[model samples]
Target: MTRRDYYEILGISRSATPEEIKKTYRQLALKYHPDRNPGDKEAEAHFKEAAEAYEVLRDPNKKRIYDQYGHEGLHGAGFEGFNNFDDIFSSFSDIFGEMFGFSPGRRSGRRRPSKGADLRYDATITLEDAAAGTELDLDIPRTETCEGCTGTGAEPGSSPERCSACGGKGQVYRSQGFFTISTTCPQCRGTGQYISNPCTTCKGSGKIVREKRLKVKIPPGVDTGATMRLTGEGEAGELGGPPGDLYVLIQVRPHDTFVRQGDNLYVEIPISFVQAALGTTIKVPSLNGEVDLEIKPGTQPNQVYTIKDQGIKHLRGGGKGALTVGIRVQIPTKLTREQEQLLRSFAETVKDTVKGSGKQKRNFFKGF
Candidate 1:
């Protein structure tokens, strides 16, 4: 081990930031590389020094210990520097591989198990079904693990071979100016495995697209924009991971009779002005059925009345909402000769009720 300071080897300030240290190390490594000065032992020594300095400073843990207690602290912590050129190249393959134009080997853990993507299903249900809870069978098209090859993408009793293009790393490297760019291998398409003998059922893919029939239960009082999640019902996973979820979005269709807001139901009932003036009992439409509602005398237009427990049911709690009925009083547009005589006789009994305008009073007695 060299007795010189790590920062001094990389030609950076002692209080330099991590980025500054890395930049200085990159310049030193590029300048004193053995490839540029093949026969110069001094340049080889400088490259080793820069690599060692970078290997220490790039790591926060080792850098902290070194910053606090120096090289002896790193030694006590069991951090021996690179032994040979192979070690330096292998350790910095991610950095140097990108700096130069060589493919970095499979060091990233990209081959681990990955969960499948989630799926969405849009369903429109009648408002009655939404209020009363119903069960439905849905036809869904999705990919599942192939039964022929058991998700291996190969013929039965045969295994997939390692990708030759990417050497099972699933990535290909190409020299682009001063950087090496990595991309998915065209031959293997990032699977890192090649299927020479493919399964006849699903071609070479590890999954198959098929329509699945599933029965789902919808709770009462589910409105539009409500979402339900079904776990493990989505596309099949890759590398033996768990399957994803299926999201069911529900849209409740509009009703012709009732307008729903939250748990309440509203309906307008039109009554004649005669009925509005005199108390009467009438049948009102509700979620359950026709129920009787009483209208008091002199009931004004647009007046609202509530019928208890006649609206939509609660989703979680066990109860029902009230039904709101709005009164709409209709006046007679035309009257017969006998009807006008009867109205004129009635106006004489209640003359004080007809004193709004002079024109209206004149019109009331104009026929008489």
Candidate 2:
């Protein structure tokens, strides 16, 4: 029987890249795999067809010849389609591993140990702590190796025995028409070992959920959204596998008196109108502590003053940011009659001086 075009079979164009071709083949193979669609002859045939196309297109030399002379040319070069399921699986073990996460040939034995899942913990800190760095003890919840079974899941005096269903192998093979397919052994769950007497503590799971207290030191300049990774601090692995990592996500609490932008801090300090016009030294809040700031004469409302090295530390490099203080001039809401009269007299004198100069400043508080 004449075969379909390789590109057409894989549902790809002739100009498809190698990665695109492999991706297409992987999808098709996974969709029509016999293990997934048991007792379906049409799906098995599609799986074989995809495997054959992938086999030729994955090899550079075979692809070059097939591109030049087509399937007829591939036949002339001694290219034969897969003879059986084993042939197809053996030829595409790597691709199958990418699809099923393990080599297909190893299905007949114990599955390889896989790393445990990584975990995440959210950590909150004050803005001051973020600026100066702090040490904290965190209570983390995770899975740890069981003490009763020592990670084996078997009782103290009893050990796991070989699975009888798969004859100590991890997988069981079944004959379906012209194909022999292997699947994970249900009795042992692919471990090839069965616990006769389950561990009382972990109940044959090999892991226990417990809370662990860990001391963590947060470096200075760590901002919100920064992450710290602690290796080997996640869930315990299975079957002698390595433990995963723990990620701590930082969340900096909002400051009551300051706002941070990158490494800079902004603050608004209220000063009396008399102090603003006459200049004075006042204390302002900073991440470090209270610091004295000098207000120059003629300091206007909303005017800004900067204090160097008083803000948040740089997260990446050296030096710190500046603390910008915005001036807010306070206007007295209540005054005695005598005080009001005195202010009115002062305003009249200032108006006369401006009139004598024959000049007026724009928006110079004419009402005041």
Best-fitting candidate, measured by lDDT?
A: 2
Distance (Å) between predicted and true CA of 179, model 1?
A: 7.3
User: lDDT for every model?
Assistant: 0.84, 0.87
Off by over 4 Å in 1: 1-106, 109-111, 173-181, 352-368
Encode model 1's per-residue lDDT on 80-126: one tens digit a residue: 89898768876876666567543344243135567888999999998
Instruction: Note the residue pairs that clash in candidate 2.
Output: none
Off by over 4 Å in 2: 1-11, 14-109, 352-368
lDDT of 1: 0.84
Backbone clashes in each candidate structure, one number apiece? 0, 0
Q: Write the per-residue lDDT of candidate 2 for residues 1-368, one digit (tens) a residue.
A: 98999999999999999999999998998899877787899999999999999999988999999999999999999999899877887688777644553334434546666688899999999999999999889998999999999988999999999899987778777665544566779999989899999999999998999999998899999999999999999999878799899999999999999999889999999999989999999999997789999999999999999999999899888999999999999999997989877776777787644333333554455657
What clash pairs does model 1 have?
none
RMSD of each: 12.4, 10.8
